[model samples]
Target: MNERVNGLSETAVKLDRAGLDGMDRAPPQLDRLEREFQTFMREVDEAAAQLRLKAKPIWFGPVKADIDAESALLKDERRKDPPQQEADAKIIQPERLDPSQENGKFAAGSLKSMDADTGPVRAQPQPSGAPKMGEAEKAEGGSSDVFHRRLGPINLADNLQAGIRAVRRNLLVVMGFTLATNVLVLAIPVYLFQISDRVLTSRSTDTLVMLTILIAGAVILNAVLDAIRRFILMRTAVEVAAQLGAPILGAAARASLHSNGREYQTLGDLQQLRSFLVSGTLLSFLDAPLTPLFMLAVFLVHPDLGYIAVVAALLLLVIAFINQKMTASAFHEAGNFQSRANLHLDSMSRNSQIINALAMIPEAVKIWGQDTAGSLKAQVLAQDRNVISASVSKAVRMLAQVAMLGWGAYLSLEGQLTGGMVIAASIIAGRALAPVEGAIEGWHQFIHTRSAYERISVLLKSSPLNFERLKLPRPQGRLDVERLLFVPQGTKRVVLNGVSFTLAAGESLAVIGDSGAGKTTLGKMLVGSLLPTSGNVRLDLMDLRNWDQRQFGENIGYLPQDVQLFPGTIKANIGRMRDDASDEDIYKAARLADVHELISTFAQGYETMVAADGSPLSGGQKQRIALARAFFGNPRLVVLDEPNSNLDGSGDAALLRALSHAKREKITVITITQRPSLLNCVDKILLLSNGTVAMFGVREEVLKALAPLNATNGRPAVASQTPQVA
Candidate 1:
């Protein structure tokens, strides 16, 4: 079942690589090789898993096979007997004895006695499921897929139209400078063409001096103008990238609650958007039609030769296009190989101890190699195409040059063209070829940038969560849910079916349910992270959607399951959402989150910078920073999702104290917890069951309803009693 091909395996992998220096070196080639190896390992892993399954071929038991055959034979025999006339009338409602009630519970086990849909659903019952969806609190940033499919090429006409329409005063001034610079640059070529011919014919000193001065002036002006153009371009590119990235980052933020982002997305995807804005969109405008203009002009002067030049260039480019089309499947294969290869590497690195103990290093490498080989082959084929194309173009250019030299010799001898003219024509032809290759390069760049641009656009274009907008009510921590139904992700069963609950402001509420129960989804809706498909969620007598973001943000303090910290001083992070807050305010918030002491212990105290995404901090430390962020605006509602995940004992107690302090500050706290101890701390509990509130009331009352649904290690004592939330 091990699919790794030996013999050439070691030879195929070129582990040691020489760095690029002087000639005979390239870095990208080595990188490609390494990537291919990694890709092979990924392929080997997947294939090995599949082949292992195949190797253990299933053998239908002899008796079972015979039973199946006999069953078929008996069915045929039954068919040969005339079909029973009353076969369809075999419905039976067998009489059953009712079971006795054991204590307050119904002890009868027969499913036939139960009528699940016999009456109206409970209008106001308690919720019993655990509120927290996952035990771990997540970091603050949202993850997403790497490649987002675009809706064809972007219609730039809209952006272009708007740009022209919104031609602001500053932009017009910059445009004028750009136009003036272009005019000056274009005039140089014309000047050269005219002066070269005239100087060759007459050899006038005055003419030469003037031409020299003109060229110098043009060069100087062009450089200065280009600097300005670059400045403008930078501004424009940043504006566009931001215009594209902000909404995308926003969407990613919006999607963070439901998506863990492991499938196919990363921060790199968003960076691609920025890159495309600066390079791809701006450069592609020249990719079309410019060649035709040059060809038309050339044809007017030399009908046959111009046509040949155009034909040859066009034919060369056509080959490149064909090669690109052929590489699509290869590129896709390469991408898959790359992803799996990376995963393999990550797994190997993270589980080095496991591999070391098993002494499976060679096997691990071999597996990685197996995953990556196909992609390597594809890439090798692609590289071959590129090299061959380059070599062919070089060959073709040689032929054309030979022809040009021969033609030029005859024309010079006949006195139809001068030696200098022949040289000039040859130079012009070479210039034409330079751009042809550049055109192809430009095309390649376009495809890359376009790919990235499309991803950013998708993030921007998605529909936001639905929340009905209503006027703001001073949040008093009170909440109510009536006739609520929730379907947790990846399951057919509902976690909360016909659930209802109510809570007073400045009070604490705990949601408890089975692991898959819709506890997290319910909490998410309350925090404006998700919208219910078929119900209304209101906050403080106002619809969530009705309030502008500023108002909602100012009033609702939501702590996500994952707490992500930006790379900055502790004070800076707390003051981020409240720009006007001073150092004292940030310190106060940090103190409330119980992280001020930790900040003080750092070498820089409150000024110590956290590495990007808080890599320097432990999970517990990161969560506290996030809690500090939640407290920034003195919001009335404190919604915590698994805040105690990384804390233990005294830490947990301290976190609970913070929650209690929030309540004392008149801020309502709704927390999701699976721990029984945390439940005891809350005033009320909403126990969720089968996508409905099983019970809702004071903690003791809700616990009574959920007594039958207690679980161990997150699984129900009985399968049917468990809610399918995940």
Candidate 2:
């Protein structure tokens, strides 16, 4: 190996020395390119490092060395870990509208978390089996129950009734104005026909002057009434829209948990229905309805020709019916395509950042483009049918008018119909056919609009969170879990099996566990966010199943893991309801949560609007605000899930101080967390294992049982107290 290397170096040196070789070192451009490539690689590595990955270890009992690999998404439920099996059932929809989960978190660094303003909404445990607070704690500070409004059923006649009322009032006020304009409009041709028959026949100027005045008056009259009609029509549309929007969302909010909790589809259908109301009545009114009114006014003046006009309308209707029936299926399909394409575009917009980041731009664009193209293609076909339909209808209308004109002329020549009558009849016949043309346009729009309304309605009627057979009085905050069976609400996984514990008023319990320990699930059940499949969460002497809905909501305050902040003034967000809260009270809560300083620094201070979950603030700042919102109600019990996850040391210290304050106030604080600092402040700890109580009792006593496993490589004898795990 050394001789061969020496020969290659020697050959290169000899060749260079002989001046046969061009260079001895790499080029400057190559060095620059190499440096640039390295920089790019560094960036890619940093970006890749930020990706989130969930993993679980598999250990063959007492096995020596464990192999590391990516954790697989749980498949074949029968073989999955119990926790994973439970989670699988809880997922709302595997095929969801939002595709962000397919890859992971937002590709645009970190997404700002959304915190819903719970405001005065308390999530007290249900009476069915949810734990309750004692009388002492309840008397100290109690929250208000959730208010549900009654939403009546939708009757088909409701809309038409509204329309009839509006139109009648409008017509009463405008009909006289319309009549004056109509008479003026009719007088022009009538005067001309009379002049040709009388004045021109007799060479007179009286009718000529009258004809001039009538045409000018007709224009003036229309200009005035048309303005009023336009405003009234617009007002009518607004009234209709307002009436439909209100009862929907409010009704959905009031629906019984058991009745429509599964009908999430109802809300989407209702939205579609409202859209139909907008396009069907308002747009079509101007497009087609006016034509019929004009036709009707003319027919009233000329019966001799109106009969011929009526015949023409019948022919037109026959043609229109044939055309509509033949193309109805295609138009319906087009409407559906447009709706789907619109939804597709919305999905694309939300995931644009991820698609662009991973060079999946073309794929995303392709999906959107396909839908758009299909929609456009359907529209073009529908447009063709419409045009053909319109042409056929128009031809028949013109034929009827021409035939009427000929019949009128023949009658006048025979002295059966007068000359003025012939002219008036012809005009009247054309006007009568106007409404038929309007129907075609109105019918199409009505279908699409109705479709939209139906979709929106479905969305509005979606089922609320279910809490069946839970009708007991509110708890007083005494929670008992006696040999309770743990059943995952979404999935059938057993997080806690035969677990037993008791939470008394004025006591704080800190539950510390690793991820997948079912800590969050238990917290949710306690706070009414979720219901247990089989376990009994008893309150005082009774089960939560028997609790009253309204009263239960007032007793407990819950802070979920994902905080949702509403977009509004800080004061509005924090105080929410109970606007009666004093400025000092809000500031105290803010200061406790450590968000007072952060919010006060904004331009508007507490009045400042928080856009998109307080984008102006950092994660810790937003979290502080959420914490403040949670404690605003001063309920009997507070259940917090990972409240300190994003807080810095300072923020965390402030949070602990606030929790200490809550304890001092004699509030029952149940915390789900993994933070060690929480262990020091809690009155006791509950250790959960395999959906069962691994350990429970005072913090000092329970910690002794977990000490053996918590011991380091060089620690003294650790465990002292041990509570047996079932």
- Identify the leading candidate in terms of TM-score: 1
- Model 1: residue 421 alpha-carbon error in angstroms: 3.7
Determine which window of 10 residues in candidate 1 has minimal summed lDDT: 136-145
lDDT at residue 250 of model 2 (Cα atoms): 46
| Model 2 error, position 170 (Å) | 6.9
TM-score of candidate 2 against the unseen true structure: 0.61
C-alpha local distance difference test of each model: 0.56, 0.59
lDDT of residue 601 for candidate 2? 77
> lDDT by residue for model 1 over 255-329, one digit each (tens)?
655655322342355455446434533432322324454455445434544655666677667766875675555
List model 2 lDDT by residue over 1-726, tens digit each: 355446545655654565624444435534654575566667665544332111111211221122231122123222524663453232223232123434443333223222233112233433221113233232434333332311322332343346447656765555555455544556556665677678778776876777668767777777777666556655655565565455444444545332323233334554544454344344333433344555555456556566666677677778668766766676677766665666666656555656778998788778767777877777677667777877778787788778877887887888876677667666655655655765665555655555555544444444332222233333435566656656644577787677667776557888876677777778867765555667677555455554544445545667778776777778877775455666765776676556777776789899877765466667777777888877765655678888888889988888888788777655678887777677776888987666666778988887776666565434454433432221
lDDT of 1 at 322: 73
Clashes of each: 56, 69
TM match of model 1 to true structure: 0.61
For candidate 2, the clash count comes to: 69
